[model samples]
Target: MTEQIAHEPLDVLRLRARRRQAGRRSFRQALMRAATGIIGEIKIASPSRGRLIDNARPPASIARAFEAAGIDAISVVTEEDFFHGNLALLSKIRRDTRLPVLRKDFLTTPYEIVQSAAHGADAVLLITAGLADDQLQPLLSEALEYDLDVVLEIHDEQELVRALTFDPSIVGVNNRNLRTFEVSLNVSKRLINRIPRHILAISESGLRSPTDVIAMKQAGARACLIGEALLGADDPRAFIAACRPAFVA
Candidate 1:
């Protein structure tokens, strides 16, 4: 017989736990007040390395490079299962820099939101694909109470519609399809017209060069969430800085 697997109600458990821990903190308001531009993302290698393993860069070095390059924000992956990230690494990055740190995780409940905010994250990623309509308000509410900026991410049309339901301040269009793992820049461009102009629009995934930034800006994106390209570079910061329009000019 095939081995059976046991699963816990992680979402339910986390939601209950977060509700009990709720207290005023202020990440959302600060994020809204801040500028959304050129968010440099830091990704750790998974324990099971992929084809990009040869280019792994330490988080410290990565953070320093991005800072020197003048990035507006920094995102640290805290997912351990697939991204090979650690919460400890995020804490270290947070303490080391003044730039707003975004906790780039699969945030599912208020508990995870509180944990991120309390740990010094200025922002948190909320994927529309992972949440339902009824579940979003509670999570967003708790995150707001903790003063965390929410980067609501969507992968497609349906998720985009769901994301708009919250009137999010910051919206990220992820090019990577969560199911097939395929990436296409068109994802963000396709959804751009539908997004409200007042909201800070971010393009994520498949962004490779400064040209990509130009294209995205022209397509109406205010910012881009880049991970693989920077992580794959020998000089990550320089690569990101080079992508800046001012630097290029």
Candidate 2:
């Protein structure tokens, strides 16, 4: 499969965002309401772990289940290389559910940013691993101008420093070490508080239970972006329920 490029002009995307942008689900509002929000992810496979629920359930079915579980938001992995995901899946899930759909991909180019919005994403994930210093600001600026939320995903302190410069509305600390693909829940704990109080902090990957969720909250993360464990669970809701923090009046 040929990798897609940004053929659509930025102006065209801005016009379309105005004319056809779907009503926002207010993911930022959702985060403000909980101690530890769960952004349930829709993924078929991953680089470290392959083929999660390949033939077991379709994207729409899993989405319905997440809705039934009352997921705070939904992340649709759209990269095709190792993840077996497509932009079409994002559109399908977005149309079927009111949950804010995040286009979780290795998006570095402006074309991919516009394509993510055009394909029905309410938010887009931007990882700091491979992005050039020059490529960073334009992508961030365009995504915001296009009316899409940007989740600044960082794996370490260096990336965290760069992410803060952009002043992202949301920041994600990925527990998985991209080079080794090893997951450590501590990555979120170590990095969350360094982020300013104004930003919504998210911990991604390596979370498996309610205890893990509680720990993340204790460390100051407002949300957790989970994928594999939920997809592999016999009941994904149980996974979600186990992760939700006990809120008190």
Candidate 3:
């Protein structure tokens, strides 16, 4: 799949992406209406924790479970090398669920943005730490052209500054440090408030338990992206319900 992505002509990919005429799902609206927006992630493995779920459970089944659990949206890790995910899974999951699906990958090019739209992604994650200053705005623009929402991900104050320059509609504060692979909710706590209230703030990574979710909410996060905990849970629906704000009922 990596080889295909690398060798395919940009024109060909663009043509395919533009041909997709599926009705758009509004990721931004999903977060805006939810009492406590929860984006359940479909991931098979991670570099830090290794394999997260059995291959027997398909990605579409996971999407179904997330939808049933009342998650606001879905995030599918599409990077094949470290995350053991592929674009095919994104398309399959999108077909099976009503929630908006965000393609979570280290996307840096216009072609990747187009490919995501072609593969059924309602949104795309662009990390501030990974993109150069010149690359960030253009990539955000490309996603917008495809009618795909952007999740500008940042890990610190510096990246937060860089991300805000693009005036993104959504900002995702990732708690996991890219340098050491360490996880801390403090990262989210520190950065969330810095983002403007008009832009939706989403806390991502290392979140476990309702206490963690509440902490992020209190810290000013309107939403969160949760993966490992949900995948490892004996009852994902119950776990998700538990993670909701007390007022949600």
lDDT of 2 by residue, 30-114 (tens): 7668544888889888766778866757888898898788678899988888998998899999889978889998887887787
User: Residue-wise lDDT of candidate 3 within 1-249, one digit each (tens)?
Assistant: 467777766777777667764576889889989876999999989887888878688778878987897788999998999989999999999888888999999998887888898888999999999999898878888887878999999999999998888888999999999999889999998989899999999999998877788888889899988888888878888887887763253
Tell me how far the alpha carbon of residue 212 in candidate 3 is from the true structure, in angstroms, after superposition: 0.5
Cα lDDT computed for each candidate against the true fold: 0.73, 0.81, 0.87
Q: Which of the predicted structures, 1 or 3, would earn the higher lDDT when compared with the native?
A: 3
Candidate 2 global TM-score: 0.91
Instruction: Please give the ranking of all candidate structures by TM-score, highest first, separated by commas.
Output: 3, 2, 1
Residue 196 displacement (Å), model 2? 1.2
lDDT of 1 by residue, 132-247 (tens): 88888998998776567788999888888888879998888998888888889898889977899888788898888877877887788877777777666677657665666622
Clashing pairs in 1: 26-146, 26-147, 27-147, 27-148, 28-147, 28-148
Question: Which of the numbered candidates is closest to the native, going by highest TM-score?
Answer: 3
lDDT of 1: 0.73
Off by over 4 Å in 3: 5-8, 246-249
Q: Which candidate would rank higher by TM-score, 2 or 3?
A: 3
